[model samples]
Target chain A: MILYLMCFALFLVGVYGLLTKRDLIKLILSIAVMGYAVNLFLILFAYKKDAGIPILLEGVVQGSMVDPLPQALVLTSIVIELGTTALLVALAIRLVQKYKTFDITKIRRLFG
Target chain B: MPVETWLYFTLGFMILGSIIALEIKDILSSIVAIGVVGLGVSVAFLFLQAPDLAIVQFLFEIFAMIILVRAFVKKDYHAETPARVNGFLVAISMLVIIAIFVSSISVFKLLPPFGQPLFETAQHYVDHGVRETGAVNLVTAIILDYRAYDTLGEVTVLFTAILGTITILRIRNGKNAGRKGA
Candidate 1:
């Protein structure tokens, strides 16, 4: 319960950074931080106390194994995060190339 | 150590790392701090009993760090954006946090407790996974067999992202060549 709130606070930190940061790279990094915080929160949903791994070892007692579904979901999400981050950084690079700076305030062609 | 204790500690580490990453003016410090946050979250995943996720996270963190480093090589070390502290931004942020807090409290009341019953789909796969899919790991069977379509979609997403990146970057290269030729 408390852990979930902590994750939420972490997410808000990312959000605050996103809203406040004027640098393109910093914005990109903030988005990534938000993604990580969400992933951690999702992992909490499937956690079980005294749980073992979700593998099917031969003759191994399958007692209270942690839920594997969220793990699977998170696996795909992590890869997706990589893709999005790359795309954002690529866009940021192009922005810098065009504007000669990383500051969003200076890259005002799109704003007005 | 108690599980709660570990969870709290991991969360604290992650919060601290992220704050540092976002708050710092130095670009290099921001990158390193974000990596620390990533590793801290990976550790939290481990404590949450998801070794596969931890591994994937650790690997992906490496990938992100490598790309970021490459990107940073040509870019300046310091963020030149001046910090702004407008009341509107602060108000919106406070409102969002409050909304999240309220909604989360209500949602927690409606949902089942920490341990949900075994999902029948997962249970079926777990019990007969080895015999049916010939994969000793149930997670492998679940991903490769039971949810093969989902995996295919994930692969498609990766391909699309890669294609987009190549197209975008290739344009810049083409423009550079045109300049050189001119």
Candidate 2:
């Protein structure tokens, strides 16, 4: 479907930026973009047309709700992503403070 | 208008935002572009009847926005020298990427069609989640009751991440504060 293709293209655009970008923050942003694209694709892929929310509301019929599995998976992944982004940003702060630069190629002083 | 048509339109906007986010030179502008992409995706999630994901995504965008703002100093982070990326290498990489995506699409054809539950176990949860877990939301029942162990691990990861951040930043007791006091 065009929708799926478009999402994949967006993901590839993120990958392209990740490959080409020099700044660490930009690289991080690209990674997040890629993750977002994948998450969106997964949720949409699991979605059934005309399905309502997964909640069992009063008097609501069962078996007609959208899939809840992907929603739960996305929730957990989003939290994990928050942790990762936080850790990376902290590392970035340390890197910038120590090296006085954001270009990753220039900050290669972590020798054994 | 059909919801699928709306979904397509939103996906197009999201794609546009994604391209802009990656292509723009300014970091601040790039941040805004990514935010727009997130918003568009969240809207699409809602359209697909995943309100929980939509809410989480909406909040996640805010969280990411805060992180970007926190990192947003006026310092010049731009690399003065242009990157020497080889055109031929990039072309090859793109080709490989396209191949992977195409293969994935073909494999997706093997998956259960949209809206159908793939597993019988999941169907049981869908039917009796509220009565069993006492949670009205099926997602809550799944994550909290059926997959409780996974949730526990997720919490542990979150805790460890907070610890790692603190360790990296040393916001708490600095290295050898006890020794100095002694």
- Give Cα-based local distance difference scores for all models: 0.79, 0.79
Error of 1 at B64 (Å): 0.4
- For candidate 1, write residues B1-182 as lDDT tens digits: 86779889988988898888887887887888999889988888888877888899999998999889788754565554565656787788778877877787766656455545334456666667778989866667777888889989998998888888766666654446765210
Model 1 chain B: weakest 10-residue lDDT segment is: B173-182
Per-candidate DockQ vs. reference: 0.64, 0.61
TM-score winner: 1
lDDT of 1 by residue, A32-95 (tens): 9999988987878677777887876678776767777777878888998999888887777777
Q: Which residue ranges in model 1 land beyond 4 Å of their true spot? A: B115-121, B173-175, B178-182
The pairs that clash in candidate 1 are: none
In model 2, what lDDT does residue A69 have?
81
Off by over 4 Å in 2: A59-63, B74-89, B102-105, B112-120, B171-182
Residue B150 in model 1: lDDT:
90
- The TM-score that candidate 1 achieves is 0.90
Best by DockQ: 1
